[model samples]
Target: LAKTTQPISMDSYEGQEVNITCSHNNIATNDYITWYQQFPSQGPRFIIQGYKTKVTNEVASLFIPADRKSSTLSLPRVSLSDTAVYYCLVGDGTPSSNTGKLIFGQGTTLQVKP
Candidate 1:
């Protein structure tokens, strides 16, 4: 598994955009970069996933560099409700390759203030 490093914490104000970057220097060719958001006492929720380039969903956007060595999770117009821990996971997340194995490191804590 490729090791990922992220900021320990970030502060943002309501209606601001937040971009949290994760570094995975040893990423593999078949690995996919996925981001998750977890609130207090709740399971991690999928934010976005991508292999290369950019992917956007209703909630957030994920950008993976060509080297596949890093990714960024972008949240637009964040609010107090968006304050949570954001996790960056790198693995074979394809449906056919899903192994139900996920190693989560200490995630980035996002603090959204009013």
Candidate 2:
């Protein structure tokens, strides 16, 4: 299994953009890099996913390199409301991945100020 590592925290002002990168060195062949954003009291929401190259959605963009060892999440024009904790998780499974167990890291706390 691949374990993810990200920043413990980040600070940015309102109206500025933010980008959070995660590193996973032991990623599996069937694993796909996935990012999730969380608010103060809400569950983590899926941001984006990618195997390689680039993938974008309404909220964020996911950029994966060829080696599949690292990935970046780009958030455009962030605001104060965007302040929250972000988590980077690798491994894609239907009901579960391999043994049906997921190990999440401490998570990166994003602080957006005015």
Candidate 3:
């Protein structure tokens, strides 16, 4: 399985832009970079996904460089409610990739203050 390395924790304030970077040097060509956000007691919610270049949505944007070895999740104008555990997952997102499953790496705890 591919692995990602990210900061253990980060601090931000309201109305700030927070960028979280994840490193996956062993990423495969078929693998995709995905970002998920998990609240204290709930399951992780999909934030964004990208195979290459940049992908953006209402909530976040995912940036993947040309080499695909690392990615950055950009959260614009983050608020206190945005505080959560952010995870960077690298996989093919297909049944064949992991024999019918996707493996997630440990997450980065982000603290949003007022």
Candidate 4:
């Protein structure tokens, strides 16, 4: 497993775009990168996942460079409701793997103000 590093916290106003980056210097070839957002007392919600290149969904966009050492999660026009802790996870999430276990680090706390 590769360890990840992220900023302690970030602040943004409503309707502004926010990008949170995570670094995984020792990522393995078979590992997949995933991002999750968690609110107070709530379970982590899956935001996005990618192995290489860029992946986007209705909520966020994930940018992974060619080196695969880091990734960025882009949230467009964030609002106060988006304030939460964002986590970057790295592992083989394939069903065949059958691990069903996930490890998370102290995530980046995103504070969205009005």
lDDT of 3 by residue, 1-114 (tens): 788999999999999999999999998778888899999889999999999999999999889999999999999999999999999998875545566346777889999999
Candidate 2: tens digits of C-alpha lDDT, residues 1-114: 789989899999888778888999998877878888888778888888888999999988888989889898889999888888988888766435356456678889999989
Error of 1 at 10 (Å): 0.3
lDDT (C-alpha) at residue 82 in model 1: 98
Candidate 2 regions with alpha-carbon error over 4 angstroms: 93-100
User: What's model 1's lDDT at 28?
Assistant: 72
Q: Report model 2's TM-score to 2 decimal places.
A: 0.90
CA lDDT, candidate 4, residue 33: 91
| Ten-residue region with minimum lDDT total, candidate 3 | 93-102
lDDT of 4 by residue, 1-114 (tens): 789999999999999999999999998787899999999999999999999999999999999999999999999999999999999999885566777456799999999999
What local distance difference test score does each model get?
0.91, 0.85, 0.90, 0.94
**Best-to-worst lDDT order:** 4, 1, 3, 2
Candidate 4 colliding pairs, count: 0
Cand. 1 TM to true fold: 0.93
Q: Sum up the clashes in candidate 1.
A: 0
Residue 5, candidate 4: alpha-carbon lDDT: 95
